[model samples]
Target: MGNKQFSQAQKLTILKHAKQIGPKEAAKVAGVHYTTVYEWKRQLKELGEEAFLEHQPRRSGRGEKEITPEQESAILQVWNDNPAFGPGQVRSQLRRQGTTISIRTIRKVMEANGYTAKQKQNQVSAPERFEASRPLELAQMDILEVTINKVRVYLILLIDDFSRFILGFRLLEQTSVDEVIQLVRRAVDQYGKMEELLTDRGFVFYSWRGINRFEKYLENQGIDHTHARPHHPQTLGKVEALNKRIKNELFGQEHFSTLEQAFSALTKWVEHYNHKRPHQGLGGFLVPAERFHGQEQKALDDIANSRDVTAQIQDIERSIVNLVLAPDGSVTLYLLGQPVVIKGGSHV
Candidate 1:
């Protein structure tokens, strides 16, 4: 039988008949599938007859658009800000901005604006993923080769496995063992020493014959060096994915005439990736910086409570020397020997 649209009254009648003479018999009598009868029963039981009134029948030509002009404008603005974002990312961003929109509506807006392209879905089964329990527990290091202005260059990155945070990165003329060591040392200096370091079996990282300088440095720092299986890039999937993202979002979009320009652009892109961009791996709401700084739980709690988590004092005019809380529950600030009183009571 062809697909039929049933009114709420007709659905109620069918349900009544189904109650009298089983679903299968009712479906046979009504010329509808038995499963459809059961589904209608489920909807009626869970949501009452009003659910049928809200249901829209499928139609041709994209059906009726429900997004408002303001919503469409917001979606387009988000796309303009970050052209690399897909519908899911756009939805996440809008949610962060206090605007909850559906992924379908965002995708429709993108398709209407000619900002979306057909992408082939990957069919291969993904390997089992693993992550460190805490930040600085393990760090993954990798090097990506790129040609900038016809000059061969390498981009080395050290990322925290737990947070997927880029601890340190550098663009070098060559992938030397000393440069890799320097990168690791800088990362260690900035964010304590990692318990373990993971890398692929590159000559700079591993020694086929004897321990390389990089391996020796890790040993001196009391960090265990772990190498990925030979010929398996998925072993270092996090860093590999970051390399691909950099290629697509940074290199593929802009043309650089010098390594300096490329390095500057990479620095800004990495900042955005860590602080601003919503990472899908981190539940598509928390950024890597929050996880790295141990603020993941607080951020999650704020989001759950429907509070604005992005509210922060970006700049302060005067330097804060000290904050004093009075016995009467008032706050006083001492800035350069000048006192400023901030009321303690909640504001309406």
Candidate 2:
């Protein structure tokens, strides 16, 4: 018999009968081909009850095989906004905005748009990585020197070891013990005081003869100060990686004529990094701001529940005027006298 047309309910019943009897027997009794029954079984397994529903089969085409034109446009738009994003990053960004696109689709879209990803270098096995158990447990501090407009300046960065969150950063003409202390103080005042601070044995952070002024300030604030071993950069690997990212992603892309321009650009870049950029270390989805504000668990739960974590990112305004934590585990942010509440992986 020829393959017979079947209604949705008929197809479901046939699938059930196929499971009871052999697929060939069921197909023979139903006046359909055994291959058609097998296909139906596969579809039902893959798509559940929706597989039995009558729908137009997607047409195979050159550009419309996997994703729609609108999705391709979105991929290109995200790539244009962040030229530094790789296929995986592009996919995560789209997923954040409530659109789920595969990495292969994203790559195809990008390549069609004349964007080719560079070959990844073969990575060597490195030492075992370590991070603090929670936020404010240990903070890493570093200084990077850059020459803009033939004028040298320093970028001081302090980041939480647990969340890799930028506690605070400053672009200064000179790096001094006082400037370092001020940055640390500002970070402490903004986020609660960290339990410990980690830094390399620079003259500003450490002294050969005795404790430096920065060390004294840490002691006064009741924060333990620790120094990386001399001549060892891996000890401060996280902060060093951040410096390299700044070099490649920030200064490498944009040219600034004045320190003011560089500072302004750096501020915006840092904001994007903290709030938008996904951290590979944080399971390739969660941003630093979520972890910094103690929303990591809730955010992870949202992912587990198949809910969008983007709500947190969307609701929290950038450059927060003030952050207030409630007793019920909700976080409130005040932006220009407007208060926004975020709780349980969503914003209220």
Candidate 3:
């Protein structure tokens, strides 16, 4: 029962030795204790020669508390009925019905039976990574393929990295580089330009050989074009997160007779999404518009009356003395109200 278990033959041998010598002598010879020898002698005397034979025990602990088949079946039944309920929820529900079980045991049973976990991850999550600090710092573009009324169409989306604003989108029969460029341009026009435009290396957005028209357009506009890390969509985390929200909450669930109907609904939804829908990242569930521009209703009137604009203008004026062209036609520009000029040997 302890670390040592005596086989039937070993028990018989020990009993015979005990009969020949004594309990203590038999224990010393067989590397067992006198109490163990005495217990075996009592078992042999009580049951005769059949004492060494054994039958399976009716109850087993397996080093843990027993769980009845009915209780196990109840756990399986609850899990099968509500596969979506996590382990804690399942345990709580079972407790409401007066059956108490640990989440650990439920999880173990679920896993051993090849069923999905009811609960995973601890409640708290790690902080977000690679987030931008300011509005218009980085923008991302992505395209989603959707099927409506048996016809295939695409949803092109653009979102700001910081505010998570849905800058602009288009639902079209197909994606084209010109449409994508136009979308970015429209976003810049509306929200001001971003420092970089991040997108996947899809053919519509990028080409490796420097012949991509979209790349050329961005370059000409003085906007940096960056591709998301190969096969890693999290590089465009904000846009991808928005895309998943749109599909799960809108496009994937709705029914439409035509693409036009879908587009019309989406256009209205985009308006609400930009101006009304609360975003978690913004804090206070502030809408993207508030986070981006903030109280545009009478904001202009306030800015005009406020000293901030005048102070910015005075600061700019003080930072510039003059731009001068040297004899060789090279120019000197200065901030801090000074000019340092240099000249070439000759101008050809």
User: For residues 1-348, what per-residue lDDT tens digits would candidate 3 score against the true structure?
Assistant: 223455656787888988889776886787654545665665677677764456222332332233445666878887775454456655644553446677766765565455553346576544357765455667788998888888899999998776677889999998999999899888777657777788999999989786689999999987888888897776777787777777765777789888889999898777766764445565422456654553322323433344222112212111123354657777655322123334663322
Give a tens-digit lDDT track for model 2, residues 312-338. Answer: 774653243546566788775544223
Clashing pairs in 3: 86-118, 87-118, 87-119
Residue 168 shift from truth in candidate 3, angstroms? 0.5
Clashes of each: 0, 0, 3
* Model 3, TM vs. native: 0.50
The C-alpha TM-scores of every prediction are 0.71, 0.70, 0.50
Candidate lDDT (C-alpha), each: 0.78, 0.78, 0.66
After superposition, which runs of candidate 3 have C-alpha atoms over 4 Å from their true positions?
A: 1-128, 295-348
Local error of candidate 1 at residue 85 (angstroms): 0.3
338 Cα displacement, candidate 2 (Å): 28
Q: After superposition, how far is residue 51 of candidate 2 from its true place, in Å?
A: 39
Q: Estimate, for each residue in 127-169, the C-alpha lDDT of model 1 and write its tens digit.
A: 8899876677789999999889989899999999988989999
Clashing residue pairs, backbone N/CA/C < 3 A, model 2: none
Q: Judged by lDDT against the true structure, how good is candidate 2?
A: 0.78
